[model samples]
Target: MTSTLQPVTALTLDLDDTLWPVRPTLIAAEKVLAEWLRANAPSTAQNTPPAAMLALRAEVAAEHPHWAHDLSAIRLETIRRALRKHGDDPALAELAFDVFFEARHAVTLYDDVLPGLERLASRYPLIAVSNGNAELHRVGLERFFAGSVSARLHGVAKPDPSIFQAACAAAKAPPHRVLHLGDDLDTDVAGALAAGLHAGWICRPDGAHADAAPRAGAHRFATLLDVADALGV
Candidate 1:
């Protein structure tokens, strides 16, 4: 028996891997940040190996478990600690973090993303909902979205219904009317389904999420264009 699908009035999208490949973006951003560090803070740069920077992140996470949901806080604290220990001025950590943040937003969108977003945004109120720290204004996609919700500001990450609900609220729509798309099955699909939003799993070209098990009500698509086709929007 087929059930009539609910109409999609709005959308809540994941930022990191759905629109752009986040790993490469981060790797590029890290390289640019390292270059800045080498030029401006050589003492800290000499002592802080890339791996040690990761270790500092872990240390910050351990000491401040409450900040687990805020990536900016964790990264900033890690930078501050590194600057302090390496005899660099700790006050400069804020500036260093800003440098890295600017680089982080230099994302290359997937070929289909911009056109697809334009098409979808014309029909529905598109909401950018993410657990990551990407700012749409920085990414230059702020004009396409009606609103945004983030884990950092909300104090809860995805796979928790609170964030999903918050995204729905941002859209000024009920959960059942908003379709949510993301790359992570657990966070995006499971979280949206649990919160009663329409869920779509975006499996990127890398085939990284091939092992995901099917959820009863979820839609699986390769791109945002496919999402429009699937929804008949």
Candidate 2:
């Protein structure tokens, strides 16, 4: 039951944990932000910094059930409002946002990032789809991708299919011709396959995903460079 695989004309990537390690970056940024908050908004910082920041985010998100899809807005508004209350000055609100924005831009890309992106971008249109803050792709990684989609813009997260569909549409490519690369098996592999795109799982260097046999038709690459090689371009 062998079949000829179609050439990849488009490539969609996940930002967090795929091209760059996001969780650790977020943790590091949170630490910095917590210190800043403690200095600027000491009273509220106790409940708004570090883990408390994430907890408040969840609590506020639960209040707006209709806004689960656009958590960035919720988060931004939450931070802004919390800072306003603590500082008693609207100007401090902007400072809080600036701190977060700067911290986010400090994310470290993986070792295989530039070479792989250069190789693939030279051949096909490259796009990014991530369920993170929209700004992370737009203002953050704008130089890397030709186009992008985030839950903040699409109003839905991955594993939901619509976001992937939207990314393909933005790239002007059919799902079958697009190769989706990401770290999460369910969000990237299953979701892309469900939406009819080729899926490539970006496992860790330790080969943790070697045993994960996705039921859907998919391929696994240890790094972005391997993915570039897989396409044979």
Winner by lDDT: 1
List model 2 lDDT by residue over 1-233, tens digit each: 01324556788999877877777777776677677778888876865555666676777787887777675567666787676666545457567767875676577778888888888888888888988763544334567678888877788889888888899998899888888998889888899999999888888766446577654578878888887777775
Question: TM-score, each model?
Answer: 0.95, 0.86
Summarize candidate 1's per-residue lDDT along 1-233 as a digit string, tens digits: 01324567889999998999889899988888778888988998988988999998899999998887899999899999999999989998899999999999999999889888988888889998888899999999999999999999999999899999988998999998888999888899989999999888888666577676767788878888887676665
C-alpha lDDT score of every prediction, in listed order: 0.87, 0.76
lDDT of 1: 0.87
RMSD (Cα, Å) of candidate 1?
1.8
TM-score of 2: 0.86
